[model samples]
Target chain A: MTSPSNSSREAIAHIAFDDLVALLEAIFVKAGTAPGVAAILARNCASAERDGSKSHGLFRVPGYLSTLASGWVDGKAEPVVEDVAAAFVRVDARNGFAQPALAAGTPLLLEKVKACGIALLAVRQSHHFGALWPDVEPFARQGFVALSFVNSFACVVPIGGSKPVYGTNPIAFAAPRAGGDPIVFDQAASALANGDVRIAAREGRSLPPGSGVDRTGAPTTDPKAILDGGALLPFGGYKGAALAMMVEILAAALTGGQFSFEVDWSAHPGAETPKTGQLLIVIDPDAGAGRSFVDRVETLVGRIADAGQERLPGDRRYALRRRAAEIGIPIAPALLKELSALAGAPTD
Target chain B: MTSPSNSSREAIAHIAFDDLVALLEAIFVKAGTAPGVAAILARNCASAERDGSKSHGLFRVPGYLSTLASGWVDGKAEPVVEDVAAAFVRVDARNGFAQPALAAGTPLLLEKVKACGIALLAVRQSHHFGALWPDVEPFARQGFVALSFVNSFACVVPIGGSKPVYGTNPIAFAAPRAGGDPIVFDQAASALANGDVRIAAREGRSLPPGSGVDRTGAPTTDPKAILDGGALLPFGGYKGAALAMMVEILAAALTGGQFSFEVDWSAHPGAETPKTGQLLIVIDPDAGAGRSFVDRVETLVGRIADAGQERLPGDRRYALRRRAAEIGIPIAPALLKELSALAGAPTD
Candidate 1:
């Protein structure tokens, strides 16, 4: 199925899940990534599509290639996990993609969590260009509560400040359920995520009030002004700013990686692999509190649902994932052509 | 110094730090609390006053005594700390006051955190009548990052719903700084704390827009509408609601205590000791990372300060504490008289 574009751009095309993953794998393999790393990266990109996050799907392949071409990211680098303590795992990502690094260390970290009741995975020198949920949702599926934080290149201003001092630091959390799916949520500390505002600016649409500031720090609803020189405001004034600081400390300081202010962002937009840090925490609910934990969670969830407040965190993503699995993932025809060219294949 | 009331109300009184603590202790003892529990409870009350949180200070004493009088709380109950896991301490409060329960468990939790890199202190069946910061600040002072969440009587509506389905759940966090006071903050998930809105309604003052809704589920700025029949709105819309759910799960579900909706709030104003749950997490930064943690935190804090955002999370509390310690705490004359009567003493 395809929808013609109003502009001269190519129409959208629907692609099967396996086909999308295979195409992405070919692209990264051609771009000098090891076959295994390419497979992991492809799965991460395909999952973003499956979960309806088009911004992080195959559209981002060009940016990943840009970072790989510039040597800012080591395509074949392997992550190393060291047990710094009984309940801590330090993962040096070796300047590679964060998804693969986390994929490598999660099982090891979960083992420690089961043994110690709680565990922390401190990931350093990784480039996290994907959504935060993918890194933490796996543990929740395996009957554990997981929370993660990551610090990116500086884009958001601190409260009562004009300049960008912190990244649009995001936090993700997931809690396991007894029989149903786990509850999971991921949110940036800013009023809107950077990519979202950029999409608004690209579509020539203005933003809601309090979204960001103009170059002179005057509040503006123009998304272009924010994307250009201004900074995104924190989500809930001082409260969200405090959370951003918490993310900075937990993801950067505790992970022993570069802080947001320490990053040197480019004048022009090109994904040079912001060498960032992330921290993930996992707790075995069975170990921490036993069977009573899941029962209690189900009780609260039932109350929330019975009250007709069923749109809990991560509900939208879950719905979209089911829809995408039944149907196929939608990608623009121009994007498919670009991927095919990158993989050295003719257009379908 | 006191301000004369327009209605011929009693003027305020200034009580010395030690005198305030002694007065509270006598009242708790008269209310049938054990000597040691009374001492701990009194210090908790005095510290609230010392930090200028007058709402939680002597103002809450009547509620505590009422709970004790009603036999809803076991005034002399001693908390038992059980080593639930390698990194978890489960404190059964024996249906007693939370301050004493926390007092009994803090050292044990801190020791586990120092050894395990992170530890969780779960308090169950405790009446947490005071502020949450006090429960976490001690560990921060001892060079640990502490976070605490407590679920209270239901007063706040979940986002998109008109009824009170959740507590004005408060979460507190503190991160230690080298040679400086810890950065600390405590915030209620509701748009405003329940007591704060009640004080406003008592004073016949209007509230900010979007604070709460009237009985019919229509948004209203009238404080009385909210205090009487309406429900407080969650802070920052759905984000605050998610945080509230996080607190409910962490403090209640994980701690094996009652959720907010499960509480039967009293019809009268006096507190009947809502047996709630609280979760405290402490992490030794030195154990997690190294010396680099402090330096990185300072770097980020300095940037925040340089941007004129120096009024960090805990600065106001720290300032109030220094001033109160040097001078004395201010109390309303009416409240002091009431407290004196409860303690079987004449006015000072």
Candidate 2:
């Protein structure tokens, strides 16, 4: 009946946490990223799962590896400064990935301020940085405030109109919290975070609906149709449309890179990856007044987190990391087997 | 009927925008804003009309005056250097109006960035700064890229969840465009911009149905019901929700200010004035290795703008501004009469 229905056979694979991390770290390092960058990037990818961003998690192993394998995403490319001025900094990714580009850029930013106490950096020609949290988290951990954004494929349309011309462009910000993990935030400006929808459709699952529009601009739950000709609807319509536009201009426009339609990472899937860039900003609290600024800012965050059930954006992920460390990650058994075979190891 | 419909009987009052600016400049000077700040702020508020944001234009005068009158938003207060340390600047607005705070903070950020060449300035305890574009355009005009965001009263809920927990926060970014005005972007995170909705409702027009949901979550085109108990729907929905959350956390969370339900603009008709804050990031082009960067950026923008009747983002406003100069400022007879009273002048 119905060719043994794709629904009943659908099952999620739960691979062990350590197994996934090891595989990621090994592949990333083998691909050419410096051990330090590799470790941090892997850690960040693992961290994505903790935040329930599984689509951006280690499941991206094949995709990322392919980028390195094809030499489109230079695993060992070191970022270099492309432009610098009184109030701006642009970094050339040199075709390297985003993590190292950001890492290289952050320190340069710190250096500029040592002169005048402020700097702005636009990082271009870089690949995705997995989750933006890690990009900002370090600064927060160091008691600094940071903001960042990156452009992906353009699948969203302008407000009050149709015609897909903007990317899901994600934006992020982080702030230091005393005696706690820095508050980290990362978000995409798509109704269903395209990634989740992609993953769901790949798994033969039906979306909760209202996430996208099918061809002809009607509300839809059928993910495949939505993905085909029906473009993604903006988050709050015009507001969402405006934001998607803002991100496109900010992340790409400011960087003097691909802005509107050129950002098609082939939907961040395999083959012919797109060229994208990033913008990272760092704020040194001491520059505003000095002395107890960090502590004071931390106090503010603490008060908010303590005020009620309130917690910072990355709190849930931090909690999940703790749980993963305690109870082991819960990847599907089938996924574990495949990863194991890919690693030339067998699942226990 | 209905006390003689004010709108239909209203006449159009024509006045040179310069005259209106002069009047506003005088009022602000009298209110104690620095001459420069007052002039600039007035210019910006007036420019909002030129940009088609009438709600933030002269319409906001009474509320701004009320804030000045109440002392919640100080006219005489200046920004205080609350903190600073390499690539970061934090300003305590000291309860000052937002324009001056932004004015004071923008240059400080530009000056501080030395090596990394990126700086973030977190500003707190500030009032509205008319249009976010004006606030950021200066940096781009100076060949520096800038991105800014402002959080207002909470106006939206997270995706898949009910109840308003975040505001329809607005975000903006300005990028240099060689010889052209910087490519400016500004937007909120709701189905329809709140101001647009308000203007539509005020004009006795109906929303294009599906713009918002009624109190019971049923879709309706009535802006009144949507504003009252019905909620604003997100663009592309969940994406919109995530975006609102992103803006709130960045604009409010990182600044040691209010966030989510904590935002309350007293003038917004339903809640207290939010403990608002703004995030200003400026990136100087020369902070890196390129010189023709501005021209390069323009090439890309030009290519897109030339693509079949696609005027750049802020072009219409500028065009309108130029045309309106000759046509004269067209204010409703009702509003003109009300504002004419500001100078103790005759209503006719």
Candidate 3:
């Protein structure tokens, strides 16, 4: 595949989607992940790349490999699922990667949701490191309404407080449509994602207003100050902060996982991946609303689209996904070279 | 009962909590409401006043009475609760006020949630005209985590569009604690609630930045422009807009109710309340985490509290409620006179 020029001055390359998947799979296997676990990890990476999430794509391989090499994440561990109640499922991730654990639990959740109108998955001992949409979208595709929450390492300060007590803590929701891709949305509670803040600082750029506060508890738009010791402000003042708190409780406390503040970042400062937790809820609209569900969703979505300038959620991601499949995934040249070395292949 | 001086320089009067309830009940009864329905409505109004929610308290009685008088609401209609699925309860609100509808459905929802760990109530043909916290907080007080969403008449523009496509679309979440009032939050998706905008316009006060846009779709902070011919913007930009869309789907599409845009506001313009729908979900943490649920919530809340200068969600409201109980409710002199006339009492 030929590289398409973007505006950035960085050297670029393009790899066919299949080739990229194989490369990531080989690298994860080389880093000592079990073949099945490596396959799931590679698929998640490929999807991120396919959806234009470069920060979580090939770029995260190095961090994942580091955690694998240090034996912080058990590459061979199998997640255990338990039906704790009539409608509640508990998944013990066995300190393994989140993607595979969720993969194991989702089918069970779908079955329960069919029997009951709603079902919940409480996943603990999981290491999550990618977009949450991938974890929720499949259920929507199968005609279920899905919502998910995940808590990570603490990186955000509560509104009106000086210290960090909550994570960026993302939430994702998806609903099925009649003849189109599901309506999906994923957002971190913070005004800016940590990855975006890091990229801005690396490029010496200022952030948007209301992004973060400095160590002295004063609001600042300087990306560097925010990254050094400051804290990212939650989006929409106290409202977004409350949503963050909701995520912490649902993903951690309710799931029997460690609270964000209880995580020992000091012990693994530059080392292991964080052990986190996630909660996924799935409901079958057909159970109650019947066949009218998809038409109703389409009605609401059509109204948004007919309004001219308004775009439906996930419209951009689905468009990018199609382009990625057609023209391949764009990658920075330096990262491609690193991937080739990890894959034991010659750089083009 | 006496008036208290506020910086707004408006005339104020205080009324005993019991008196306010009795007066509201009498007014609703005189406006052709069923005696039982009027009692529930009065209780809701009293609770709102006691909690310092002036916008939803006695202030809303006039709108409710107008709807009742115009026969837009069925004062004698009884809500029918159906267990449509294993864990879903569908409430036919019968085009009546939402308070009695929720009152009829809540017991069934509570029973199902205890048995199945989680349950949902989908209310259709409802007229929801007040704060959402009261609807959800009752479940939280009984050791359940509850969430609710309701769609009203469209008054908010989606992000990136000028015309209104969504309602204020309030969402409320509440989680129980061991020894205190539950942690609760209720917020409208709009940057400024319609009621707040009206108050600001009435007082000729400027709004906070990024609150709304003028008729031509230009951003403005003038409360008059926002209320007169413009639309309120969603809070937190596109992220908040997505949440508003979620509410529309859940409340209208899933519940078989009218979407905000589909409602013919012109049909009843000044006389009737909008026909809306609401979705309520309640989860019993004890079903999954057992006795540790309250402890976990307290731990997280305590950590936030330990970080000095931070306030927990609902703290202010709880404090105001305590004060309201101690010193009675403060009302404007004009509102008092109107209430006296409605209640057939002699005016001072």
- Who wins the lDDT comparison? 3
Query: Per-candidate TM vs. native?
Result: 0.94, 0.78, 0.94
What is every candidate's C-alpha DockQ against the true complex, given to 2 decimals? 0.58, 0.29, 0.59
Compose the digit string of candidate 3's lDDT tens values, residues B201-307: 99999999889998877899998898777889989998889999999988888887778988775655465566878888888787655339888989988888775
Model 1 interface CAPRI class: medium
Over the stretch A34-106, how does candidate 3's per-residue lDDT look in tens digits?
Answer: 8999999998888888887777877788788878777677888899988877778888889898888888887
**Cα error of candidate 3 at position A196, Å:** 1.3
Q: Which sequence of candidate numbers ranks them by lDDT, best first?
A: 3, 1, 2
Q: 1 or 3: which has the higher lDDT?
A: 3
Residue B32 lDDT in candidate 3: 87
TM-score ranking from best candidate downward: 3, 1, 2
Per-residue CA lDDT of model 1 for B80-141, tens digit only, reads 98887778788889889888888888888877887888888888888888988888788778
Tens-digit lDDT track of model 2 for B89-115:
777777676677777766656666434
Candidate 1, TM-score of its B chain? 0.92
Query: For residues A1-348, could you state the per-residue lDDT of candidate 2 as single tens digits?
Result: 011112343544343465566766766787667776687677777668655678777567777767767656667777886445544667788777777777776666666545545445777777774877777787777766677778776566554334566667777877665567776777776666777778878988877654676666667788887788876766654455555665665567667556647754454345334467777766555554423554654544543344222555677888877776665565654555655566565455
